[model samples]
Target: MKSNDKLAIHELLNKAAYGYDSRNVDMLVDCFAEGAVMSMSITDGDLIGPFEGQNEIMKLMTGAMEGQMDTRLHNISNIFFEKEADEAATVLSSLTLTAVENGSIRLLTTGIYRDEVVKVGGSWKISKRHLDLELPF
Candidate 1:
């Protein structure tokens, strides 16, 4: 992979992570394609989604961000990728969510993110993302 391609991918990942940490819905939305999907596994052994479309994705995230005293710091690391072309790729990374409740912060969950990313109109956007979590159970 070219250095520039790697940089672009890293930038895209950081943008999403930071957006989530900041609770900026619009910024988080901008990191994805119009038809992106986000899924994560919960403790009850239920899987969140292939969230299917942009609206569904928004709903899932918005619901998580609303009426919650939890403050989450979504930190991402160890990103790896397989580039299919200049326009398509798959990425994987590790994530840690620092959760705060009642003014105390603790490591809430650890997970891995699998992403399908594409370059559309000269910008990289995540077309799909699924978080397979560990340690929340």
Candidate 2:
């Protein structure tokens, strides 16, 4: 893959994390393609969802955002590319989630994000994402 594509993909992943942390709905929506899918697993428990399509995924995201009263920090790191092409890539990254409420900050969880992204109109957008959490947040 080209270096620019790799950079763009990295930015895309960071943008998603930032969007969620900042509660920027529009930014989060832009990160996903129309048919995007998302799922999660916590501590080897049952799968949460294979939330199909952008609308369903947004419902899940917005719900989570509304439920949280604290400030969230979703730190994305250790990004690696498992596969790449001109228009698509599979990426794996680590998440260290923290929340701040009042004067206290707490570590919520750590997780892994596996994402399939495609270039849509010259921008990378997540087509599929699966998250595995070490603990429930």
Q: Which candidate is the best by lDDT?
A: 2
Residue 4 C-alpha lDDT in model 2: 91
Give the residue spans of candidate 2 off by over 4 A: none
Superposed model 1: Cα runs more than 4 Å off: none
User: How high is each candidate's TM-score?
Assistant: 0.88, 0.98
The lDDT for every candidate, in the order shown, is 0.83, 0.96
Root-mean-square deviation (CA) per prediction: 2.0, 0.6
lDDT of 1 by residue, 1-137 (tens): 56686789889999998887788889888899998888888654688777877788878777877856777888899999855577788999999888888878899888888998988898889998988888662
Residue 34 in model 1: shift from native, Å?
0.5
Candidate 2 local lDDT, residue 105: 97
User: Can you give the lDDT of residue 110 in candidate 2?
Assistant: 99
lDDT value, candidate 1, whole model: 0.83
Residue 67 local lDDT, model 2: 91
